[model samples]
Target: MPELTTRIGDLTMRSPVMLASGTVGYGPEYEGVIDFGATGAIVTKTITVEPREGNAPPRLVETPGGLLNAIGLENVGLERFLAEKLPEAAPLPVPIVASVAGTGAGQFAQLAAAVGERDEVAAIELNISCPNVERPRNPVWSDPVAVGEIVSAAREATGKTLSLKLSPNTSDILSVAEAAERAGADALTVANTLPGMRIDIERRRPALGNVTGGLSGRALMPVNLALVWKVAEHVSIPVIGSGGIGDTGDALEFLAAGAVAVQVGTALFATPEAPSEIADGLRNYMEENGFASIDELVGMAREERRTCAETA
Candidate 1:
């Protein structure tokens, strides 16, 4: 197989296709189905300072073309993860990226330090877009300054590859992307989930136990691609494209939109083996198209779209 070689910041990955966080759990969750080694890397679920029991029952609801999840950032916390999950994932064939979320900058840093202290962790995927931000206003990822603060703190605490997972539901994603880059983030994961509410009109109440949930799947592809394209074009750092990516074609779209690499999410719920299959399909597509590196596709559609717009 010709290598779909790509780089996320300074770190080079075997392929441009990878698994997104939250959906993949701890990577071991799908051990029964697909081969973990075949993936570019496994991004672990978001871990906080303490264990999160997650949202109440009926946490997931499938929409017309997507699903809404009110998982409430459920995680085993960083300490336990280091003592328990890290040891198990440490020996995996592919790189194990430890993901962490926080209520404030300090907690993100604390989690980063806790996980970074471990030699087993290959990299850090900071979950900045998680919407469990409680109180009057406490979204660490929403504000660009807050995002920068978290990234700087995480960077200070670890020498591992630093990636900040962003939320697409923002006024200016480019500003946030630039903020993360200025704060020393090595890479940016474009988009976490769009904030959407699902109400059970029959019951005259909210569908999810938490009332609101994070949106993912095919419905989000266009929005996600837009964010990735904008952020990638706005910044020099590598961007990891995600959201609504279920097949090889979707992954290719993200690549052409300026994403150095792409991540598969939500799709894992139905097709556990989608990652490997998509990876294989991408390899075949690239080979058939006479492409050498995945980087060849970045900003491709943008130029054509711009030219068409000018003529119009």
Candidate 2:
């Protein structure tokens, strides 16, 4: 059998297969179907300083190739998560990454510090895409300066990996990525759901109760892959490609785009075992291709395309 181990900074994932934040809920939802230990890691939904009730009814709308959701970072909040959720989920066999978001810099840093103290947490992923109630005009993540300051501040609180999850809606993703990299981020989960809204023509209202929602699934594939490829080209740290990753080949595409690993998102709604299935497929692919490891597939397409062009 070929090696499937993947290195994401100092952490080595058994395979580059991980569950994306939000999609997999609080990690216990997949109990009967998925063997939790099979995945390299599991990133829970984005946690906040306080528990969120989330948006009102009609929060989900099924599109042709994707899902629209305005979950509004609903969770048990930091204290509750630490006290209740983590204790239950921590006993699982694999590494646990607590996905977190804060109302501001201080709030984020404090939350990171608290989670950092936990031996069960392998990392804290700062969600930068969340809309800011304070600054409704400007996106907090669009500016690299803020990204730098936030990640740096969080570093002071915890040493467990510091990762910033960047949005795909930015004007220059490379700039945002560069900012995070320069800010000393250990890893980056590229391309959170783009800010989107779908109209409910029949009801003469918005599809989601929040009016606007995050779009995931096949619709996000192309745009998200572009972000991953660009960030992988520009940033030095590990990149976790996400958004619309449904199958093993789609996961492979992200690796080809320069990601160290790929997170399976929307696929969870239908298939809980998708992550493990992709892992097995990747191992098979590596063996058939005569590659020594799954990591070898990272950016392989870049080199192959270049060679093809050169030969032409």
Candidate 3:
């Protein structure tokens, strides 16, 4: 059997397939439906300092190739997550990556510290790409300076693995990514979701209550692959490719593009068993390709192409 285990900083994942934040709820909800051990890690929904009710109804809508959502980071808050959610998640077979979001740097630092103190938590994924909030006047991921500040604050607060989730809406994502790495990020989640909107022609109103939402699904695969390739080339830290991964092939594309791991999001809506299935497929692919470990496959495409060009 091929070695599927992967490491991000001090944390190690059994597999490179993680459940994307917000897609799998907090963890307990998918208990019977999916086998936790088959996955690398479970990233909880984005949690805030205080409980949030989220946006009004019509927050989710289906588009031609993706799902648009404006969930507004509805969560049970830090208190409930640690007291209620984390305890339930602690016993799961995989490591728990707490996904957190805050309107400001201080809040992010506080949230990171609280979650990092827990033994059950293996890493922290900062959701800085949320489109529903506008508290900073500018999105955190849009500005390299802001990204560095938030990442630096969180780095000071936690000794655990810290992964900053970037946004595709930025003008130059590479600059923002480099900023986070310099600020001490342990890993980088290649992206969150892209800005999108829908309209109900009949009603002559927006399909989502928030008017604009974040897009995720099959359509995002290519976009995220490019990001993983770009960031992986520039940063030394592991990159977790997220966006639209629906199967083993999609996941492999990310690994080939230099991502150490892949996060499955919108696919869960249609195939709750997608993660395990992809894991199985990944193993099969490795065995067939004579790969003894996943490390051999990570960024193989780039290396092979470079070699070809050098010889040519």
For this target, which candidate reaches the highest TM-score against the unseen true structure?
3
Give per-residue lDDT, candidate 3, residue 145. Answer: 93
Q: Write the per-residue lDDT of candidate 3 for residues 91-130, one digit (tens) a residue.
A: 8788999999987789999999999999999999998988
Indicate which candidate wins on lDDT. Answer: 3
- The residue-by-residue lDDT of candidate 2 on 31-70, one tens digit each, is 7777676788898988889998877877788888998887
Runs of candidate 1 exceeding 4 Å displacement: 133-135, 304-312
Clashing residue pairs for model 2: none
Q: Please report, in order, the local distance difference test score of every candidate based on alpha carbons.
A: 0.83, 0.84, 0.91
By lDDT: ranked, best first: 3, 2, 1
Kindly list the per-residue Cα lDDT of model 1 for residues 1-312, writing each as its tens digit: 456878775567787778889887887767767667668888898888899898887788888899988898888987789888888777777777888887778988888888887777778999878764453464556688888898898888888789999988778888788889998899999888887878899999989888888889999999999889888888888889999999988998998898888888898888888888888888898789776667666665788645754686
Of the candidates numbered 2 and 3, which has the greater lDDT value? 3
Native-referenced Cα lDDT, model 3: 0.91
